[model samples]
Target: MKKHNYSAGPCILPQEVFEKSAEAILNFNNSGLSILEISHRSKDFVAVMDEARALALDLLGLTGKGYQALFLAGGASLEFLMVPYNLMKENGKAAYLDSGTWASAAIKEAKFFGETVVVASSKEQNYNHVPKGYEVPADANYFHCTSNNTIFGTQMKEFPNLDMPIVCDMSSDIFSRVLDFSKFDIIYAGAQKNMGPAGTTLVVIKEEILGKNGKTIPSMLDYAKHIKAESMYNTPPVFPVYASLLTLQWLKKLGGIPAIEKINNAKATLLYTEIDRNPLFKGAAAVEDRSNMNATFLLNDEAHTPIFDALWKEAGISGLPGHRSVGGYRASMYNALPIESVQVLVDVMKDLEKKVSKTRL
Candidate 1:
């Protein structure tokens, strides 16, 4: 049975990306050297790195607009600190919008550097809705937010128009939709979600936003230093970078972000429509704030859990289980997830409804 992967991170990638990556792993660039053994500074690897950076900006429509892209070793978790370290000035405060677990985590890291004021939060309702009507102070060094909440299945569909700089953790839905990338001063994402494997994180920083933090930052955490070295400050995640390059190449061939956004919307609509129509299940997040990337839902009646479980499992569905914090199902529909997989899940839901109907009769 073909597995329909819905795992949140380190999740499904394009089949062609996988095949090409596999070949490169064995003999990268037909150079007879395993990609695993290739040097990060090698000419071939350098080209891969360059292309990956270029493709990321091109997809976001930020190329040559004073924004620089970097592929770094630490995941988005590291960026949680690096963002504040490089941007948050000493005694200067930052505004954070708390929508989910990862957003809260980013807030925590920001507090370590300087003052971090949570302008608004949806935590009062278990992060089921995105916060709205928040006031961002102009004195803040930057306004930081997580563009999508993977754990709670919420996403910020409408971004705030802030006079201050805007920084975001787009880890879950970076390339899944179209956005005005110019509005963001910094955008960071872990590749595991929508880009590639789990070893690299993509960071796009507007060049002028650096060097204002006032504190001496470690070289590795300094965004300006990384930009100076062209993200070759230290040995990078070579294999993961190569794989990301292939994935980006595939995305370009598929006509870039605009094309993928349409497909992603279709996938999300299919899954969410089932969640709403199925009497057996209910959505976890607020309808307005519901994420197109991760759909969290639960069986309305826990007694039917076994039947529903069997239906999806027998249909070869994986990673539909929700986070421990939210005891339900979370179907993460990233850029690479096919609408057919969503149809399978929806069909299972409908089947469960039919079975229940006949049982009641």
Candidate 2:
């Protein structure tokens, strides 16, 4: 049986994406060559790269808006280092918001470049909520924030209005909803989440945001250089990019972000409603800031853990355990996760409640 996948990343992808990616792996473009063996510079792979980049921008409504989308290696972790290197001057400062583990990791990277100021943080609250009413220093070179906290299950409902450039790490929730894509000068996400599998990280940057930092950025670390190379700065992650293109094509066929957003909202509502209505479980994050992509919850009584765990597993659920920092259960409802899967989990929850009630009798 195909289990209901709730793994946070390298997570679920469309069934069709799996089917198509597998075919390409064996016989890409029917070229009689495995996707793995093709040259990155080959016309076939170059067209794949070009379409993926364009489709990404087109979906985000960033096409012809002065933004160039690059599918590069090194994941979001590399972007952590590169963002500061290209945007922050030696003495210049940058502002960040700390909401979860990934955000904290980024803050650490930014500090290596120059003065890093944290505008506000919810660390004292164990990141159960996104920080609000915080101030971004106007003098800072740019303001950076993470759009979603995968581990903590919190998402930013709104972003800070800034005078300078705005950058966001949308790693865990990119392409899962509709947003004003043009509001930020730079947006980056690791493709492992909503976009595709691991290996390539997508960076959509407004071309005008490059340069003027006055810092000598190394070749690979420079956004302008990567854009000039048309994201072929070196051999790209060919297979991941191709798979991501398949997923994007699947998404487009499903009617783009506006279409998927409706389905995503429905799935989140179904699970969250059950969490709130069922006496056995409770949500881990603030209701106002709860993430539509990842929903973290816990049983009301820890002693009931084993029974609850067995019930879900028997019901074909997988990857429901929460992060180590937040021990409970996390239902990661990415773009490809169907609502039927969520209904199954809800049924299991109800079944568990009935079983426990009978035990008390």
Candidate 3:
């Protein structure tokens, strides 16, 4: 049986990426040393790091003049604190949009550092919709938002237009669509989703936004420090960086973000259409706020759960379970997930309907 994987992060990567990465791990770039054995400071590794950062910026249409791309060791979770540390000035405030768990966590982290104003929030709706038309404080240092909420299956389809700098955590849907890079002053994401494996976080920041916090920052936590050093202030996550570079190369070959966005929309449409048409299933998030990356749905009858479970498992499908906070099912159709995998899931849904109809006879 051909297996299909639908896990959210540390998720599926291209087969070619895995194959080439494995080969390079043993003897990278035809050099005798393994990728693991290569010194991060070595010229070859420096080139690798430079190219990876450059490719990421290029993919996002970022110009090096104002923007600096860094591959840092700490995940986006660390960025939840680093963002406020570098951008939030003394006696200054930052605005946040509380969409889901990660967004709430970021707000909590920012409070420990300085004052943060949650201008808008969706907790009242169980995070099923994005908050709209919030008032951004004119004195605010930056406005922060999570581009997509994985657990709640909601996304910020349109960002709020604010005069202040915009800081975004694009962890779930960074490269899944075309974004106007100019709108954001800083964008960060963990590479595990839609990029590559874990252990590295990518941050693209506008230089002017840094060095204004007026607070002494730890070297590792300072964005200005990393930007000035070209993300080489210390040894980096060499292997993950290399893999991320390869993934970026693959994305370019596949016609970049625009092409991928078309396919991503199609995959989401296919699954959501099935959910809407089926009597046995219903989508969890609001129609206007539904996420294209993570599609959450539920069985109409709780007793039918066992049947839905067996249907996918017997068909060699996997990782369709929803997060514990929001139960039912979540199909994370990340970039590397081929459209065929989604078709297979849809087929399973149709089969389940047929079985249920027979049971009613």
Candidate 4:
């Protein structure tokens, strides 16, 4: 049986993308050259990059709305600093919502640039719920929030309407759901998640948001420079970008974000319903704030852990263990994760429950 991959990052992609990517590795576009060895400047590769960027914006409904998508290197971690570097002035402050580990890291980076006011944090509660009623400092340069907390399985369902620019790190749930992508001024996600592979990062910026911060950003960190160069500033992550383009193309062919959102919701619902309905388990995150991409849950009895683990493993479920910081399980149901895979896990949970009931009686 094939394993149901649930790894949070570097996760599953559509099988068609895998097959197509494999073919491209051997012969790309019938050019008899590998996509891996193609120059970023080549017409074929450029078209790939161009389509990837445009399609990303198109999928997000940001095209013709003044947003430019760039596939850069260094991941979302790099964007943590690059965001403040390009958006915040030396004296200006930024507002952040501390929802989980990544959100804390982003706040730490912004502090180096200037003041980083954490409007609200659910850290005290182990980041099991999205913070609410927090006010973004109206005078701040930008308000930063992570759309989905992959670590804690909490997602921000609604964003604050702010006068300042809105920045979001949507690494784990970029194309898993539909949203008002235009509401955000800057949105960045690492390719390892829903996008494609790990080498590249997608940065979607509203053109109006750039060059406003009176700071001399280094060429490498400046979004404006990358935008001016059409995301060709320095050598890009060739293979990951190409793979990401394949994923985006896969997404587009599948009816884009809106269509995928429904499938994602169904997968999440299937697994989460079992987590809640099963007497052997309970969700780790707030029910209202539970993530549609990653669902964190725990066995009600530690004594059952051994058998429960064995059952899922026997059922070919992989990457179900939770993050080190929070133990239990994290079912990362990304775009490419089929509903059937989710059903497999749910069946395992039901089987475990039935066994527990039989033993108890």
Q: TM-score for each prediction?
A: 0.99, 0.99, 0.98, 0.99
- Worst lDDT run of 10 residues, candidate 2, spans 208-217
Better of 2 and 4 by TM-score: 2
Per-residue lDDT of candidate 2, residues 198-278 (tens digit): 999999999997898998889999999999999999999999999999999999999999999999999999999999999
Which of 3 and 4 is the better model by lDDT?
A: 4
**Native-referenced Cα lDDT, model 3:** 0.92
- What is the C-alpha lDDT profile of model 1 across 1-361, one tens digit per residue? 9999999988999999889888988998899999999999999999999999999999999988999999998899999999888888878898999988988989999899888999999888999999998899889999999999989999898998888889999999998899999999999999998899999999999999787667899998999999999889999999999889888888889999999999998999888888888778899999999999999999889999899899999999998899999988999999889999999999889999999999999
- Model 1, position 38, has a per-residue lDDT of 94
Model 4, 1-361: lDDT tens digits are 8999999989999898899889999999999899988888999999999999999999999989989999999989999999999999879999999999999999999999999899999999999999999888889999999999999999999998888899999999998888999889999999998989899999999999899888888999999899999999998988899899999999999999989999998999898889988988999999999999999999889999999999999999999999988899999999999999999999999999989999999
Ten contiguous residues with the weakest lDDT in model 3: 59-68
Error of 3 at 357 (Å): 0.2
Question: Could you give candidate 3's per-residue lDDT for residues 1-361 as a string of tens digits?
Answer: 9888989888988888899889988998888888988999888899989999999989999866578899998899999999988888888898999999999999999998678899999898889888987888899999999999999899889987778899999999998999897789999999999888999999999888788778999999999889888888998889999999999999999999999999999999999999999999999999999999999999989899998899999988889999998899999999999999999999999999999999999
Question: What is the lDDT of every predicted structure here?
Answer: 0.92, 0.94, 0.92, 0.93
Residue 268 C-alpha lDDT in model 1: 90
Scored against the true structure, residue 210 in model 1 reaches a CA lDDT of 85
Give the poorly placed runs of model 2, Cα more than 4 Å off: none
- C-alpha lDDT (0 to 100) for residue 300 of candidate 4: 86
Clashes of 4: 0
Q: Candidate 4 overall Cα lDDT vs. reference?
A: 0.93
